[model samples]
Target chain A: MVNVAGPADKIEPSFLEVSTNKYKGILSWLLTVDHKRIGILYLFSMMTFFSVAVVFGFLIRLELIAPGRTIMGPQMYNQLFTLHGIIMIFLFIIPGLPAVFGNFFLPIMIGAKDVIFPRINLFSWYLFITGGLIAVISTMLPGGSADTGWTFYVPYSVRTTTNVIPALAAAFILGFSSILTGLNFVTTVHRMRAPGMTWFKMPLFVWGLYATAWVQILATPIIGITLALVIVERFLGVGIFDPALGGDPVLYQHLFWIYSHPAVYIMIIPAMGIVSEIIPVFARRTIFGYRFIAFSSLAIALFGSLVWAHHMFTAGMSDTAQFVFSFLTYAVSIPSAIKIFNWVSTMYKGSIQLDPPFLYVLSFIFQFSIGGFTGLMLGALSVNIHLQDTSFVVAHFHYVMFGGTGFGIFAAMHYWFPKMFGRMYNKKVATWAWAITTIGYNALYFPMFIMGYLGMPRRYYDYLPEFQPYHVASTIGSWILILGLIIMFTNLIVGMRRGKKAPANPWGGATLEWTTQSPPILENFHTIPTIEKGPYDYSQFEIPAAKEAQ
Target chain B: MFRSASNFSDNVDAVFLYIAGLSLIVLIGITVTMVYFVIRYSRKRNPVPKNIEGNLTLEILWTAIPFLLFMSMFYFGWVGYKDMRAIPADAIDIRVTARMWQWSFEYPNGVKTDTLYVPVSKAVKVDLKSMDVSHAFYVPAFRIKKDVYANKNNNLWFRSDKVGRYDIACAEYCGLNHSKMYSAVQVMEQKDFDAWFAEVSKKAGVQPTLVLQLKK
Candidate 1:
């Protein structure tokens, strides 16, 4: 075991160097119950899948660079996009922040040594990897990858000759992983907080995790049922979702969206929590409207569930159903607005540091705003009719999912890299990467809004020559985006191998995780400490004499 | 280069402009505030940070204002939608059937065509159904779309003031040749449309084989 001095006991090694299990080297990692190790394992797996999916996404964009048949045919293009969505959604973003950062920091943030059910947490990882492998394997199997898109809209899904069953099984298994992780986080938060750490006293990141856990547990089962029904219908010729068998396709839409819609929130909420956590630390101020930011997470979860029908606006639902969902979709926007306002206001009159993490947080705000506004347009009944299945929907979600949560994931990686790996990355490279990424991201997605408004439908293998210019620009933007990713990830990897040792607390301010050692000890703390003040209280760091001298 | 030929396009475009205008203002306001805060209160310029715990007034104001603003957005959207839903009494009913890779528009006089033919300045209500999977009838110029599902009837109504051709696309993803599912709405003069309908009706009786051509 590689030994390094921990914060309290100089002899104690960090969690990375030691394992609870009696094993050496790789086995120690493969079979350990340590939450931090599990988090690292998740990171490795997620990045591998993310890289693969990124190539698929890049290829998809490349194929769309011209009007007709740039590289691949329609069937291959369809399959690539489907695999990209399945891998990105099920394997990457859905379990992303919660699995990596949440698993690593949630217990420590709450002053607990480990999650309430550590083995189940590890089991969830196994399920996640297994599901991910099945999804990838389906792409290579006989009938080729599923081409019904990630939503697997019925009738089409039922009619296609693809190997959709394996993909469905992958999603179903991944749902179990998601549900179990949520169950663990919910229970851990409820029962494992340090003494005197009440509900409001917990960090906003914890609150974000708590809120997301409830969504995962409650909403994921519906998708499981929906996917299972599709598989059953495929095998038994059952009249569940297939219209030829007297079943309602719209009913399947309802059931599928019921879970999938909240699944978006599942992707974003933890990222929001990350935004909440990083803003105050870099700003060197108490977060503005802490209670509102905390409460909005719950509000998003509750109201986000009710607005699934908004996706079905053009799918032959009643007008009453239409307007009701339209209104609720608008209502959901309020909580997200509250969050953005609160994040921005946190910067006011505060000593701000333009750190790499903070830079990402700023981009998240900027891109998420575009996402939120376009989402507002889509939520409106009149505009949705025009923009529903167009490239506008494509651009809008990328702004939110990729721009918001994807950037959030990057921010967390930058913010916590030092703490996670006990090494600091090159700040100059990270900043340059961020700048390029922001420019590339906007260039890639912004044109879609205009083209979609001008009648460009999504999932078209070939488009009319009119839309070719926008597609070419977007494909070029993807190249720039990929270049930025390469630089950012390479800098991080190089820094990890050979860089300055990180301090226990690199960014100043308050949080329970920051109080521990870099890479933290086997049990996050030498002794479990009791909480006394709020998570963002910077008053302790400010001595009156020091302040007066300054 | 965008088309605004239908009655509903104006309503939809107005909503789009209203939301886009407000969103731009709000976005600018936010980005400006954030950048200003970062520059004005940089750690070098203002080392001692002020720890102001949230203002109750500001919180309530942001929440209440967005609530009102969103409610107004909902109102405008609902109004336009109501207009679209409230079909006129004298609307022409046409049957639209979508299959794997094609669309067929059957006129009221039993004249079926791959391209949708409707007279100008008329409220044409198209009843949509899917012969195979789900497909959506999307006319970008008209700013109207409705998913045509198998075994279910969904209808969309639009009135075009312009006498021109507008592109019709299958908005939903339906299997292999989905991108090739392109049709057009030929908005003709009322007299020209009547004459064309009469001529096609006579030929349609002898050519029942035309129906089989449209099916696959």
Candidate 2:
């Protein structure tokens, strides 16, 4: 019903110069309903939040560099650490790839001009920015930002005179934004793919986003309700979670993890999609087990939701409940492991090119493997009882969230840099940056595992003398990691402003996105394309006519 | 190597080693295979790629093997965990209450102490309670930790095998001074524990109803 392919003026230069809009300056960007423009706006907002969260993280590390207070008191330290988690998890990582890259590329990859609901798309971005601003304003309030640590566990959250509700409210509002984005994506995928493109022919990345969107829609409401309950308990004296008013606190943990655990899959599935996209492009081979890989994404999403209670192993539930959750946790790992096996196999006996993106993928596989296997360790009931709330758990989280998702982000940025903007970055510098960050990231997190096994707990402002050495090593690693990030991002900014032009299909990618110009025209395709093969069918690409790409 | 100082420690460690050791093997194997494949199939070396769709046999083999492997791991973990969770009939009872930044331990004789004192070679069940926010009672040497919940009956049991002082910590993130919420568990011989228990009984107050119900 929608005329997505646009008018016959196919000679339009780019989306940036949509002469029909005619409203020249900042108004065009602010009021634009274009999906590409909306995606760029999301990128800018995430960059700001991510930069602040990184600084907050670095400062937390600096404080923990010694046995006692290094720079600030415990009150200030608690606020800084809590802010970092709140901003990083809520403001940055959770909404990251799905909002920015997914919005930008999903329509283009599926031969759609725009998402089904463009106004809602822009509204979600506004919601995200508003939620982020509330968090910043809460920090400047009378008592300071939330010191209840992002979980905002009961009693402390109720008793702490700090700005708890505003921060909790911020997370609540952000959930609305995520849910809307998921709705837009699911509808667009269902209604907007080109005529000849069947569901199986869609790129693996779209499948990844599809699975993630369902999670966002399904899992986000529980957290919203949970946050609302917390506020109710704090102000109106309704003790749903606070034990002070004859309430059950463990129930709060159950409800919180039910959403938060699946929220982790929402953070991860898109990253896995990015990995799938990168491996096939660099390997120059049709993906092995395409159906299996696609279904596994769905499997990860489904199984991921069921394993939330594994986190509550130490919470003293019945033996039957613990056993069932632990068993389900083991089952969940199967789909994730299947993905890893298929990724490695995709590389076997194929033409491999070690570009910056591929290099990041290599390290992603290495580091994410550690993250996955250690996750199994945490899932084991006996082992988890010992490791819960320890630095080992902290290390495992970083290995997955930071190591897996963070590296997946880097890989996607490099892999799609030429397509998003119309330029190529300095390859040599990019490679160097990857090596440094990979080394620094591992160095920063790996030591925490050993220290945790040695009985060092997480979320401590200060620790005993025995932990000083590991903390010192971790702080030094943070410096290297930050340095690498700076160089990588600076190279990208310089490239976007002034660099060599990028070709349409730089990596010989077989996706529909590579068929269009870099920084695609306003109405994506010159004409709607009819799909005839799977997204990764490299055999069709071997023809000489296809070799003459721009 | 971890100090196997509690009866459950060795069992927990065995499960940990079985999984961790197995993980080391699998991780290294996957990494090595991946690196090998990358180098062996570089564009310069293999200009043309084989259009091999895939082998169904190989996919089935890998999936089935991993499925069976984890089931074994689940069994190993569950068996080790079952014993620690079930408190023996003669297990000694200690009531532990956790607040924002401190720990309190109450013995059967209505004896209160900052440090947890128990007889070695005896199963001790700790009845956990939180006076404020959620906290976790953790003893790494024993490889045993359980959350202390408010308005809930949560408990964990362990038998100390070594006669020495070990650490007790609040593993959950409770507010400021959480790191300072540290105490020691003195695992003493039977004679030493009996002597201290007799002395504490002489100077003790009335026993709480919770401990009295446990005695019944």
* TM-score of the second chain, cand. 2: 0.92
* Alpha carbon lDDT at A381, candidate 2: 85
Q: Candidates' TM-scores?
A: 0.97, 0.96
Q: Where does candidate 1 stray beyond 4 Å?
A: A1-11, A542-550, B206-216
The segments of candidate 2 whose C-alpha lies over 4 angstroms from its true place after superposition are: A1-12, A19-22, A542-550, B205-216
Best by DockQ: 1
User: Which lDDT values do the candidates have, in the order given?
Assistant: 0.91, 0.86
lDDT of 2 by residue, B64-136 (tens): 9988988888888888789877789888888999998889998776678889999899888999998888899
The 10 consecutive residues of candidate 1 chain A with the worst lDDT sum are A541-550
Model 2 chain A: lowest-lDDT 10 consecutive positions = A541-550
**Candidate that would win on lDDT:** 1
User: Per-residue lDDT for A434-485 in model 1, tens only?
Assistant: 9999998898999999999999999999899999899989999999999999
Interface RMSD of each: 0.8, 1.4
lDDT, candidate 2, A1-550, per-residue tens = 1222334323347776662256877778777788888888888899889999999999999999898889999999899989999998988888888998999999998989899999999899989999999999999999999998888888778888999999999999999999999999999999999977788998888999999999999999999999999998887888688887887777888888989999889888899899989888788887888888889999999999999888889888889999999999999899888889889999988888888999998988888889988998888888888888999988998898989888988898898888888688888889999999998898899989988987898898888788778988998999999999999999999988886777766788888888777768987886787777788878755522212322
